[model samples]
Target: MSNAPVYDIDPATFWADPYPDLARMRAQTPVCFVPQLGATLITRRDDIFVNEKNVDVFSSDQPQGLMTVLMGQNMMRKDGDDHMHERRAIFPTVSPKTVKNVWKAQFEAATARALDRLAGQDRADLVKDFAMEVSAEALKSITGLTNMDWREMDRVSQGMIDGCSNYAGDPAVTAHCDDCTASIDRHISERMGALRSDPDLSLIAVQTQAGLDEAQMRANVKLAISGGQNEPRDAIAGAAWALLTHPQWLRAARAGDISWLQVFEEYARWISPIGMSPRRIARDHDLNGIALKAEDRLFFMFGSGNRDETVFARPDIFDPSQDIAPAISFGAGPHFCAGAWASRCLIAEVALPMLFERFTDIALVGDAPFGGWAFRGPLSVPVRLR
Candidate 1:
């Protein structure tokens, strides 16, 4: 040990290439507490899985925790029985039956509209326009805020989360900001008062009818939009970027002998948009031989775990043939991502359709910059999309 009181885990490494730093961390100390980062960093899948189930040890209840502040106590932010109950209330809405009956067709429609906007363009910033547009629209439908301009909301929310760290300027009073989230709050205030009866499919109705209040409903709605905002866009952008960069995979996808679902599994693993989801301890805890006090934050490196040499062979390379269901990129345990189906739907219905239907070859034209701590993905992916 260098006796360095702190080592600021160079976050920018995640932007350039997260794997190298992750590899170094896993090798040096899989459970090493980085004082600079203000928490323990679990480098293995088993550590994260064990801690997730043992929520008493992990303590997900802290108010200042990332989940508390951003997403609130819908699911990922809480522990034990209460967490289970809260999660179950709205969980039915995302079920396969619910999705097949409701979410999928609407999602495909949104996909069509988004791809229509990009039809004749030779070059496109997939991060800004296409990916974000489709993500915003899909979330809007899922949450029953269909009338809102989801595209702008997605953009602003993205800018805001990216603003969480390293905005490099006055983030508070920044007039040009407040981005998508400000709109969400505005929408809630404007509409929540007027709509005495909730829409049939609204996320609010799903939970409120299941037994919640106006305040709790507001938390769920805000959580739905804010936390749900960037995922589809990031997943799609990163997947498309993954395919574009790896021509061999694209060829395989286009060749089309295997089912599309299989292609998507490869896409999800290969891109792995959300490298980690950060969590903070609600109380004192210990696991995997590491002990921690209350209020200590931990970063669950999902990407690192996916690439763990113990589990994955040739972990660095982007391979479509591997069994990625074992991976935790969409999270695991009780806190698994609710938007996973929608995320996968976007890739299948929107991204791949545009890709397979339109162009022959796509190439990455420049370096891909990433944003956010928990929901990290390419910020702007420039490509020659012919």
Candidate 2:
């Protein structure tokens, strides 16, 4: 075991191809202090699970952090009964039943519409033209912000994500986030007025009915936009990139021999979109012999855990047939993403297959470089729709 600090991995290299570095860290220093991140990177699958499950020791309610800065104090940052209550308040809106029944047709239509827009293009950047557009449309429907421009919605969502992921507090990122927050405030206020006059079961309306005040409603709505919009967009692009790179799996997926759900899960594990989640240490504790101090930031590297050799056989391989356990891409325990079902429905069942069906012979134009420190996925997937 190398006792060296894990900050040796360069940020640029890790962003480009993280699997090798993740494998090395998981083997040598699964729970080492990273000076760059100022957090103990928990890379092993079991350790990540333990950290997530033991929320009392590793608290989500950090006094100051990126998530808190961007999302405010929403259900994601809450603990214990408060978390449960707030989660339950919005659970019905994104429940699997609700997503499957209410959002399924909408997702399919959005996917088809996105593909229709790319019909004549000899070469298209799926990330911008398809994935982002479909995800924006879905988010608009989910939040009842259909009147908002999809391009603006995409820009705002990306800004929020980039700001949160920018651990160094980039000025441009902060400005973008500030702008997004102002826009969201206006949107929420308008929606509140509309709901007062006449209400439907959108996410904002449901949260309002569940007794959230204006501030709480705004925070949760921001959370919804950041998580709901960004992750699914990346996942859609990542899944397509995955299948495109590994054509056999793509064929299997199309042939019905392998389920789309399986392909989605594999793509999520292979290249997790939301790569890591932060938790504040409530007290000094020892995790696998490493002493962690109070208020120490702990990052559960879901992307690393997904490829943990101890838990996953041929961890680096992208094989959908293997019966792998559920990845922590959507997180675990109380902080598990409330919009997980909706995200899966949008990406795996609707968007991914829709792209393949529409462009039967789509080919990658060039390399698609995946990026991000906290959130990981392809920046763009340029494809030729022949």
Candidate 3:
């Protein structure tokens, strides 16, 4: 291990371009400790599968830290039966049936309206103007927070995710998280009263019916907003980036030679939005020959695992037609993303097709760089939409 290359997981470098560092880690030290993060970074695909699936050995119930701070005591932090109960309660909202029978048209309409707003503009930031707007609107529709401003809700969601990512300790991040939490609390309270007087088919109503207390309801709402908004938003922007940059794939997608769903999958594998997931070792164990003690923090590098050479041929290439394996972007095991169906529909069926239909030609106007070591995606994808 002495000969293993050392990589810094700092904000500046890691977020700038994590692939190279992640590649090195995967090659030399697939399970090595990073002093900066105070945890072992796991980079290989198989290793992450093992870690995510074996919840008994690597627990998701992290004790009152970054995740709990940002998301509260929600399903993301729960284990065993508690996690399943919380997940099942909210499953209907994000299930394939709900997405197909209910949310699909709404998602399409939201994307169409967002694209309509961008009609007059020669150039626009895809992330801000389109992707973020659609994601925020979708969350509003799903949670029945119609009165709340989508932009404000997005700001709160972003703050919670940013605080969780920069969990090492940043005063501004913490303050923003606190403010977001308060806002969520207020929204939850309002929704509770609304449910009593006039109920609707929303996630809040579902949770209320499940008999979850105030804190659990708020935490789960935060989790839904944060997970639902950011990952899918980034997925849209990332798919746009991939398609625009790789014209062949774009042409195939537009010409109906490839399924839009396949394009979305390839984009996710090529540029994972949520790059890493945090886990804690439940007890003393040996992982891929590396000794891990109890309470050891582990950062499962999903972004790296998706691009593992062993998993995908020419892993770096953005080829949607290749026989690509399923990526770990939405994660694995019982903790797999509940919003997966909705996210896929929003991106593949609604957002991507809408962008293509509205714009004759799309090209990057400036450096639309991808960042965020943990939650990765283009910060601003400035494009000329003709």
Candidate 4:
């Protein structure tokens, strides 16, 4: 409706403060064709996904932006039989039961160590000190890089995710992304080789034991890193910020004398790091009355969806007792974020306890500056603590 530069938008507007814009867009039209991205993005929760009948008109297999270059033919970017194959190979590693059993201890131990590091610190940037450290350790541990430096791992992973948002927008970014991808490939190949030769008690070993083809294993590792790297870590940091700011949520979460997982749902709703899932339609489609052609790029604004007035009461304000938290940060479709359960486990173990123990107080020191659009998160969370 308005001739605003929605496509070429700042990360802060969308990540730091996206509710108003999303409300304006969602209320006016759930699906409006954006010429810049050449696709209609569905903004409403109800009309967010196309039904089974119209599924053929809009396919998730056809990739866009950095995905086209990076994950051109990856399992997620493939359709039909190919997509199903990849999903099967990767599903066991990220399934909820697997995460709850196998990864939970490692995640909690890593979280405890990270929290100990900041036990008596006067003040700290949660993003730099706790969130990144905790997440990096858990992730590297899962990948069998137990001896890797957490900071170095953080640098590489954060660089890759942060680079994704600006890669297509700038020549320098595009070049840097090429370098990053090469490094990730090398790391994955080396790990794959290790799994191939000397088996260990790791997911890599599990994949190999499950009779995954060499190529499939390689692709699965890369896909796991790409989907679950900085995004989930940022979310962990965001979750801590939410708990610290809302003592009720933290107190309730810690008081497992009751149901705590419900509090996680609320905390996650407050600070969803992946504010939106960007996708490109594969064919011509009618999206909520809007005519969209093939290869149209759309952003499913999770930040907006979580706070939709039509969906939630008083969308802007945070509520720990929200009966429903409809956030699409993971995504919503056939390719709806395969690693959702593992990520939630990581956050549950890492962020919740750290907030409960270490920091007595956590508040926004100033205006929060967000990372790029693709990786939705605050770059820093300055807080005053005891």
RMSD (Å) per prediction: 3.3, 2.1, 2.0, 3.5
Instruction: State the lDDT of candidate 4 residue by residue for 1-386, as single tens digits.
Output: 22223433344455556555567777775555444343345566655543311336545455456654653356765666777776776666677877788788888888888877777776778788777887777777666655457886776665555555553377776666666666656766667667668865455766787787766665555556666667767776666666667677667767764334555556555555666565566666655455566666666656556666777765666675666645555665677777777777777655665565566555667554665434567687777666
User: For residues 238-323, what per-residue lDDT tens digits would candidate 2 score against the true structure?
Assistant: 88888999999999999999989998888888778888888898887777767778888888899899888888876789999986
lDDT of 3: 0.83
* C-alpha TM-score for every candidate: 0.87, 0.96, 0.96, 0.85
Distance from true location, Cα of 8 in model 4, Å? 8.2
Model 2 accuracy (lDDT, Cα): 0.83
**Segments in model 3 whose C-alpha atoms lie over 4 Å from true places:** 1-11
The candidate with the higher lDDT, 1 or 4, is: 1
Candidate 4 clash pair list: 38-296, 39-296
Error of 3 at 236 (Å): 1.0
Better of 2 and 4 by lDDT: 2
Off by over 4 Å in 4: 1-16, 35-39, 50-55, 200-203, 210-216, 256-260, 325-327, 360-367, 371-373
In candidate 4, position 255 carries an lDDT of 72
